[model samples]
Target chain A: MAAGAKLDPGKVRGEFPLLAGKRGKGRLVYLDSAATTQKPERVIAAEARFYRESNANVHRGLYDLAGRATEAYEGCRRRVAAFLGADPRGVVITRNATAALNLAALGSARLLGRGDEILVTVMEHHANLVPWIQVAKRTGAALKHIPLDRMGRLDLEALPGLLGPRTRIAALSAASNVLGTIPPLAEIARRAREAGALVVVDAAQAAGRLPLSFEKTGADLLAFSAHKCYGPMGLGFLVGKPEVLERLEPLETGGEMIEAVHMDRASWAEVPRRFEAGTPNVAAAAAFPPALDLLEEIGLDRVRRHEMELTEYALERLSSLEGLEILGPANPEERVGLVSFHDPLVHPHDLATFLDGEGVAVRAGHHCAQPLHRILGIPSSLRASFGIYTVKEDVDALVEGIGKARRYFQG
Target chain B: MNLDDLYRDVVMDHYKNPRGREPLERVDIHAEGANPSCGDEVGLDLQVEEGRILKVGVRGRGCAVSTASGSILAEMVEGLTLEEAGRVARRMKGALKGEVRPGEIDMGDLEALTGVRKFPVRIKCALLPWVTLLEALLEKEKET
Candidate 1:
């Protein structure tokens, strides 16, 4: 955390109250950031301060408090737009990444018909897959999956063949939650443009971990969640180019999205508000800026450096264990601070139970990516993900815990 | 929070070498259960003759607690009437929830699973087979 020094989680962990609990040194090692991140005390305090000092229902009241509340809510829109190098008017807030994907999918139904194609990558979380599947079912469009290579990376050569004349939309994840696979978006976006397909990116896993630029990625629409990025829960964003966002229709119809209201007929608001239908989560918006502050303080490049070191350390130690096979690329540079592995001799559920006794938390199960699990020919895998607060000792604890589980269960 | 409490020796033995794991050739009623939260699944087959359950075939893939619970249910339900099996299942469910003392009935090896009650998430793993067996009993008009 100091100038010209390595990241020290001993100092960084002090910012999180959960890690600062009754558990002593080496008693708890949380390795499940892919599921959800632990909130910092500052982010928690900002939300409490908003409710305690300035809290009001936004966009309806005409009082000074209402104006402050609206500014506090709209303030995050500007902050996020600036952070991602996007236009402020293009950001539409939602409950989570799934809501944003559903909104994008529902809007795409207008562009498709029978025989039309929706090209998607096979390395998607269900959040990115199910919505498009429902849209295909509704509009008679065919859902096409771009295949994966032997190492679980996207088969880039097949993209040209899959993106045909009728390819209306191309949906893909910026990074995979299960295999830790990160796709090359610029190349995919270039090919999608040749076939005239809209590119929708699910950045739920890649947002804060990587230095992301919406304009640079050439995506027409991008979505990400707040909770995964150390921001508050119950808030997410669906950002798009102004032209593309304007053409899409609102998924939910409610009070906040009206331009003019008649008993039987009503017009919609402008680009972003038309998509945001209901009353927004103002407290979470007020709390979100501090999370960005923490990310900026450490700097994304430093975060990347720290995570690469953590991943390499973890992959090396874990691969040395007998019968342990990692799911993704062996190189840490390809992954985004997470490693998923499986052992034939020990089930993930049983391993997770033993690890819990050692105070090491991990994710075990299909991770909401059942299709990927089925493709890999396994019921479940264990994931140990790192955050900015993760230190070398944490990875050592995980390796030790896994070694104990193998000895206890395999014998 | 002790691992020994949840992963007893008897539990691991059943997990390593499961019993009645092959699908039955003939069954009167069939039911399948899956814990989607953990992605564990199981299928049950009942061979009922007259009023008694002649056999319970178990097939599934999961952790020590789940496979052990299935193996225990498979061997424990043999030769009991469908009504008696259903009663035993309901009582076992109650016992895992810590709602009753399981000593009233002769639980046999099924008592090995009572420690699973301490882990709230794992209780589902220990109960999936028995619940599916109860479902099989109900489908053929056999319930207490």
Candidate 2:
């Protein structure tokens, strides 16, 4: 699937009400999809429909409402599992990607031994990095970070040496939220496997855009957020291999996740339910099927191509602007549909403010990756990330807005 | 809101050519404040003599709003009695929240920062240095 695979950017824009709404001067050119995507109509309607029609407790109750609600909720689980090419039994619903990462980290605690090393990269978002830090502190494990090359790609050459026998887990992000670098996951997974370390992939940035099959990906566990994929907020999932998940101790405990409860002790439920405790975000989970439907309708292969084309256009436009320095790889193929940059005369906050006035929404500051910014020797950078609805005209508007910002302060 | 309202020429002037953004050799009180959300930080170096701020020094790297606010704060607090400096910091904080305005007080160059009230998210940026100054004053008072 490529650019013209039955997916029209113009039509896609219309499907999102927020994207369709008019700004004072122009339409809202949302370039902050990396932060959180504007929800499509199908996803929005699916969530509202659940509340309006059948809202009941899932995994409990014998009434018809409960049955309907359970079907809708579990249906989404199966759909998402099939989409990621993982066993439905292994998919555990989460509040967001951060919760999933935390669960993965805490659950893996029993596997870690004193003096073991938890390997990660400097490019990881704080969500992926901090949890491992806590685990290392809790256990006697030592934490090490694989440094990024000057181009912001993981220093793969050093990864082999870093993943020694003492490494128990290698936590890495599938894509850099700041630099947009798509690290070679297969190679890293292979090295981690050879080093006898479990591989945890934070697919928060790469989930819907990339065609990821849990089996083919060679990762023992993967975590991602739904909001970043045009799905409703407050919903995400963690896909773990059954044997690997069985080794993880559940981070949460309460109703629904227990098989038997005594006065003092309890035997937990199976894998997915064991991790999910108490009342889940059922409405949001029900909406996830439609979100996956939207992705399937457009096809992930075409999504990849569409974003690559947009990234290429964005790179070319950004390169032409004076004083703008792009971070990460120069080639669009090496990254996703995002570009982060620093302007010599304009601070990212000032740049974002100016762009906001021009009706272009972009993210600024450290983007929750302060270590990467520190490594880059900058306080903050401006980022513009694309989505399915983004078009060439949107890139043009961004370029025009940058020109206005340059003249506003430096002129 | 217009970008000019937030990034006024005077604000840019202070940002481009900051004043007193260096470490004082003999500091009586030093306090650090950071807007962790944006990774912007402000460190204050104050030298007090006879219950007054003899000198004020500022250090940090941040956006135009933060850097300019720090510069204006460094210039404002020098040679003021500790109580008077506290009053100024309070007034600046009030101005950022729209509870006070430039004409309501003798805020001098800080009047240029009143526009920051419109950008709620950036109000913390404009007030980080002033907050640090207030903390340093409290620390100095505690030491005395």
Candidate 3:
């Protein structure tokens, strides 16, 4: 089920209960994987099974039950590390990608100060952008945007000029949620390294879809949520170099994060535990492996292949509609699995509502990228994103729905 | 609810040909409202004489429901006093949910928005205009 294997989407769709559409189900087409993927029946069962048999707090237990809980939780950490080809010692579990990115930002305070600059792309989702803005504000550092080209690719030519002596952190998204723009992270990482800046990646949208390697990319830190990667929510991780993990501050400073506490001061725990300050989402962590195992079996390369064909067809059909425009790169080779578009004759919200009525689910709005929207000069846009469960029929349904929505609104 | 019920022709009419969008030559009050989640923003300007709204003007960018809601509300409140407009604004929220008492309020053309009732997520869109109108009234109170 790994590389070069052809994935049968119908077979994959059957694995997801919601997508399988049991009794009273209609022609449900889900194209919002960028938001969150539909959990497979096995993934759901794994979570329920955890609660039924292994319901115990992780860490701080000598008994067998606690040992099982700790193993279940730590097992997930190892799996996530192996997924990204990173060191598990540096993986600190957080609530979600936003929390992981926030931890990365807040803890990177030592690397930023007055007159330093934080570089983020214009295509960043608010998850990656807002945190850096806060870091810049807190540290008196300047926040600058790496502008996008007309086709929505990051302007790499201007990056050298931007990566001057003051650049402390280059926060980049491995794949843009809205535009589906995948930047050359390793190249940017190399440049940032030469500039003596730490490279932080937001892979929330790319994790399960790309054959990503944290070590190979040479980025100091990377963050992604499990929910978007076919896993459950309430679980995310910050993967980084073990030494890099030590240098950052922990935003949460209580519970398990402490080593020894006095009335006046306390010592913090080592690496990841220093960052994970509380009892974690063990059930979700236990549930996550099945999802990752499924993707690993199907292969990220296969998933990428499947989504690309659907996306290529979607981009062609969507743009073929009268007055419709695609916001990002039209080439499937240039991006990942999503396509964001707008019809001049219909508002995105109206179109989205109309599409929902037709049983085709998509996301409509800035996709938490208001800055990218401003660059594109659109208030908002509609996005049809693909997942392992997506089929060619779904893309056809999306096209058909948009046509009907336009006629209804124009009438 | 059916899509037709939600996007009634009457509602779409206001969306396509919105009323009260031109800038008022004179203004007594102004307020800007934005629904951050949906990315809808509406600016309201009113010409009031002794509590009666003489003219209503609005500038907006959003979906048909929000634009139409703003247009419909601006037209209905044109000849009404501040207190009456306040009552209408307050009543529209209830009206969206079909919760109006038998003789309590005449929702009139606002009923076109009843289709939005089925979509709990879009309720905010239908209420955006009325919310802004209330904000404008509150600002007037601060001045007085």
Tell me the spans in candidate 2 whose CA falls farther than 4 Å from its real position.
A1-7, B21-26, B99-104
- Please give, for residues A1-411, the per-residue lDDT of candidate 2 as tens digits: 355664578988888999888996989989999999889998999899999999999989899999999998899889888998899998999999999999999889999989999999999999999999999999989999999888778888888778898999999999899999999899889889999999999999998877888876778999999999999899988899888999999988998899999999999998888998988899999898888888888898888888999999999998899878899998888898899999877778888888999999999889999999899988788999998999989999999999988887767
Provide per-model DockQ scores: 0.68, 0.72, 0.71
Error of 1 at A236 (Å): 0.4
Candidate 1 colliding pairs = none
Across B54-127, the per-residue lDDT of candidate 3 in tens digits comes to 99998877799998998899889999999999988888877876577524667777878877878988888888
Clash tally, candidates in order: 0, 0, 0
RMSD to the true structure for each prediction, in A, is 2.2, 1.8, 1.7
Pick by DockQ: 1 or 3, better one: 3
Q: Write the per-residue lDDT of candidate 3 for residues A1-411, one digit (tens) a residue.
A: 544668889989889989876322366899999999999988999999999998889888888988999999999999999888888998989999999999999888877889999999989989998999998999999988788887889899898789989999999999889889888888988999899899999999889988998887778999999999889989999999999998998899889899999999999998899999989999999999999999988988888888888889988888779888897887897789999987778889889999888888999988999888877878889998999999999999899888888788886
- Candidate 2 colliding pairs: none
Residue ranges of candidate 1 with Cα displaced over 4 Å: A1-5, A24-26, B22-29, B99-104, B141-144
Cα-based lDDT at residue B107, candidate 3: 76
B-chain TM-score of model 2: 0.94
Model 3 lDDT, residue A313, Cα:
90
